[model samples]
Target chain A: MEKGGFCISTMASSNIAILLTIGVITVLVIQIIYIINRSRKPLHSKSPRSLSTLIVLGSGGHTAEMLNLLYVLQTERFKPRYYIAAATDNMSLQKAHVFEDSLLGKEAPEEVGRAEYMQIYRSREVGQSYITSVGTTLVAIAHALWLMIKIRPQVILCNGPGTCIPLCVIAFLFKVFGIRWSSIFYVESIARVRKLSLSGLLLYKLHMADQLFVQWPQLKEKYPRAHYVGRLM
Target chain B: MGDIDDIAKEKRVVFVTVGTTSFDALVRAVDTPEVKNELFKKGYTDILIQMGRGLYIPTKSTAENGSPALDYFTFSSSIADYLKSASLVISHAGSGSIFETLRLGKPLIVVVNEDLMDNHQSELAEELAERKHLYCARPQTLYKTISDMDPGSLVPYQPGDAKPVAELIYRYLGFPVD
Candidate 1:
């Protein structure tokens, strides 16, 4: 009789375990759907005019393309900008500083909508073998998490640079939580006429980037989610 | 540091820039006597080569006996300053150098560094070239391209406005557009 009781108890526990698993999964799915619907909430009549913007700058070509994008933006609306670059990228930050200063006709951009410069460690350096990048990538992500919490930007903008990946992912995490939903905007480099860049591909696949811009129409055809901006650089 | 205009008025300069990456083939191609002879025929009095990590460096000389003056530098903080003074620009197929020169209304010949993976730069160069904005050439065919160059036939590139992109960003962010 005791053996039959033990067997029944074991069956009951197993059934409970299965029930718990399904319950957790259902809650998760519901939460995911809720978040997706929440992200789609458009501007109401009460939306704020100014945004705390985070601009991801990178070496050479990426920096130049980003700066060109900055020129199009109405600086006042994107006030109190945070410019982020890889720690080793000295030129991008300086160029962005000069650009912001130029906007205000000043030597230093002391108050060009309160612009600030931030540097993060690059997850992978140019020509770095992928074997060792795993560790460095984790380190970069941790560093990016810290920066993202500090900035908590309303909008994050990046071109095709490896440095932006960790930050964009963290921004999506923010959305997952009830933290500020910082929308990520990615612009594919004009030089990449045919393929979506590795960075572009990542953000697209993960649904991290809210809007993806491609200079070439061919890229848009391949990446259906991408908007054909037509020669942004 | 002297005026680019003053220098440009003195003698027609052809600026050959390999951009930041080494394109040794372009450096070597420009150094050829055949290419130099063609440049001279086109009334280019001087050549300023921004070598950019190239293995081979061209020897500098003055136009003593009507031979073309040749000088080269490794890199510069302001390649735009050099581009401003040049009558013609032969640059590696870098978008930065290509657009900077084109936007300045200078005639540019974009040379493809075939060594780079997939030759992505060629696509950008070819598209612009088709629009009659610049000439596209390979290192092997640079001499032929330069010899047949017609700067007057090229059209000035109108810089694309980013206002539309800005508006899109604003709309997405829910910032009301003025």
Candidate 2:
């Protein structure tokens, strides 16, 4: 009787251990699959379909550079585009209008006007305090997440800007968690001839951008991972 | 004090633009009596200031007479119109202003806004000055710098083609580049 009781106890303990081992293994497999999916390359197809692109427009020079870049893209290929800018950046919004007008050019204004424009809270203002920046950054992040959910863009393109940080972060998080599929392309500003701007530095360090392009060869040398694509503006 | 016609005939017009961001320090520097005297001595009869959301308003001064030789606006979208007629451009070291001035082939003197977070403008001003494309001036020394500037000596800016930038974007988007 004593021998039988001991055998039963041992069997129960072994069963528990086996159950725990299976649970751990299951978790490991799920984790591996998640990482693989997150890191997978963006979808590529031989037969091209129209892609929805989210372009983050920074104020002033960034706006100008981005407009210059957009002018060269095949507009038909990147249909139903969206533009995101800071709420305070009236100039950028105006520039976007100018860009749209230039593309429309007295022909089919209503069709091209389908490209949407939205604004996110600015993360930082010139001469703002650090504490204020932190608060605003949080608000900006929330706004960016909301916009991302609404847009569900296939890809995001941004030149260097502090305002782009929150959107990039939200996009990266969504990509990692399997909430959405989107690739980020960061083009270092033409003004950044020698070094990456603060935004560029952060995005590169975090691996948020799938592809990075620098205008100058020297900048590419500094950031080996970044492709030297020559000047854009 | 002199008449507008008299000053226009005697002195070169200098356009002082601060872009879209407020640069009260630059505006204040330009507004000083000492700076005004220096400007007058240097043959700048008319100073058109594009203040751009600045709090400081140039006080109406009899120094330039009733015609208000110092004309200022809070903002204007058509800065190119002003740029066309100005003999010299004094501006804050914003890239937009720099590029626009360069595109217009105007001789520019850039005063870096040191108060900015990264001081990128100072670096840009130095770079442009090194290339002989523009001159860099300090807020304190703006008047002196303008007094000595020779706009004719500055190198004409050559704008780069945007095609390369467009091609890079195309390649990144997986579109076939022609």
Candidate 3:
């Protein structure tokens, strides 16, 4: 009777061990699949295919330069383009309207209207206290995340500005999680002659931008990876 | 005296614009009694200032009734019109103001605000000055710089065609610019 009990106990132990091994293998296989899927190039990385682009318009000079850059592109190719600015920056929205008018010129009014304008709360304002900045930054992040999910843009473009920080961060997080839906392009303002602006510095250090363009050659030397594209404005 | 009258009769307009940001230092520098006297002596009849959000308002009275020679507003949408009419523009070294002033072919004196963190205004001022497109002045040297400006020597600003900037952006966006 004791021998029979020992045999049964040994069999039960082995069965438990076998089940544990199978569970480990299953977990390993699942992890391997996830990693492989994450390693895969993003769907939009296939080629220079036309894509929906989100252009972030900062206040003042940033807005002007972005408009100039947009004017240079084949607007027809970047179908379903979107322009975003800070909530307080109605001037930028007006400017975007002017750009839309110029680009559409007598084409489809419906399509012209489709080029949407969005506004997010500014992350920081000049002279804002640090506490206020933190509060606004959190709000901006939430707004940016929502916008990113909704827009699902293939490309995002911005010149250096405080307002662009949250959007870029969300884009980077999306990329890391293999969402791979959007690519960020940062252009240093023409006003930056010698060194990177605050926004440029952050994006450069974090490797958030896929392509960084500097208007001045000297700036490219400071940031070797930055493409020394000539003045944009 | 006769020359002053002749200059006054010419209706020379000087536009001191702080752009959309306030720079109390600049407004203060321009508002000094010495500076006002110098400007009046130089025959500046009208001064239109776009103060933006600056706290300091000009307190000096005008030559007539001490009513303040400077007329300032918090903001204006018709800045381009003012730029076109102004013979000289004194502004903080903001790119927007500089470019607009240049585009209008007006003589510009940019006062670089060095207090701001990593300010690029000084560099911009230097580059534009080197190009003979405008003059740059520091807050300390502002009065001297403005007093000595020769508007006749200012080279008409010619901006590069927007084609290259656009093309670069197009190429960056992965579109072939035909």
Candidate 4:
């Protein structure tokens, strides 16, 4: 009698677990469908409304290409910019400032400083081993979570960079919670002629980015979702 | 800076840059007698190399050794001035280095770093080379590339504009056209 009762209890618990899994999966599918539909909606406003923009700058070539992309950026619509770089990358931070100064060089005094720059810890440094990066990755995620919550940006832009992953995840979480939809625009680096960068791959696979731009036409062919809008740099 | 520009104008300079990374094989390849002799024969009066933290130095390049006036530096604040001064540029397959040189209308030979796992830059170099914008070579074939390069035969690369991208982004975000 005891054995039979124990088997029944175990079977009931297993059934409940399976039902819970299905429920979570169903909710996820619905959320994804809703988000996709929401992004497709043509938003129209009578007056010029601005979005608080977030730009993540990676080191060296990534920063160079992003600056080129920003060269023709319509700053009027994407104002009050926020720039994020990795903590170890001091040069990228300096370059960002220089680019900002040049951008607002001719503007009014009050509008001179329309951007904010911040740095976050990297999950893995260049040449770092993957084994130890798990610990740092969690740290980076926590810090990114804090920044994403604090800024609550409406638009997120990043090219090829490792730093964008954590922030994009948090932005995605915010979207999932229905707090806000921080539309992500991922631009594949011009250097990536044949393939997507790791960050690009992750965001593309997860459908985290609302729009993904590939510079190379062949790359666009490989990744159907990517829009081939010509090379930016 | 003005003096350097004036000096560069008089002497044909071939600037070799690894572009902020250690490509020891490339540095070692260009530092050889065969490469130096080839550059000298091409009427390149001077060769300036930005070695980029590489341990090997091209010390064999000297007038006594029948090579052109050669000099190398580890790093520079900006390589734009160097690109501007160069009549020819042989650079690592970095897009920034490639575009900078091409925009200046200099003949270029891009040397691909085979050690790197990412083969994307190789495609960029190869594609541009196929279009006759620049020549592409590995460290091993650099000597032959330098010998056969015809700067006159190449066409200048038309740089792509970023304005379309900006417009696309705005449109994708549901912003209406004015």
| Global lDDT scores for all candidate models | 0.84, 0.78, 0.78, 0.85
- Record all residue pairs in model 2 with backbone atoms less than 3 Å apart, i.e. clashing: none
Question: How good is the docking of model 1, as DockQ?
Answer: 0.53
The prediction achieving the highest DockQ against the true structure is 4
2 against 3, candidate with superior DockQ: 2
lDDT of 4 by residue, B86-115 (tens): 888989998888888888899999999999
Structural similarity of chain A in candidate 4, as TM-score: 0.85
Q: What is the C-alpha RMSD of each candidate to the true structure, in Å?
A: 3.6, 5.1, 6.2, 3.5
Model 3 residue B163 lDDT score: 64
Q: What TM-score, over all chains together, does every model reach?
A: 0.88, 0.81, 0.81, 0.90
Best by TM-score: 4
Q: Judge candidate 2 at residue B124 and give its lDDT.
A: 62
Q: Which candidate should be chosen as best, given lDDT against the real structure?
A: 4
Give the candidate order by descending lDDT: 4, 1, 2, 3
- Greater DockQ among 1 and 3 belongs to 1
A26-132, model 4: which lDDT tens digit per residue?
A: 99889988886765543444534788899999888788888888877767678778999999988888988998888677666455447899999999887888989
Clashing pairs in 4: none
Off by over 4 Å in 4: A1-25, A40-48, A109-113, B1-9
Over A76-132, each residue of candidate 2 has an lDDT whose tens digit, in order, gives 667688998989888787788788778898547545546888988987877799988
Taking chain A by itself, what TM-score does each prediction score?
0.83, 0.80, 0.77, 0.85
What is the lDDT, from 0 to 100, of the residue A18 in candidate 1? 100
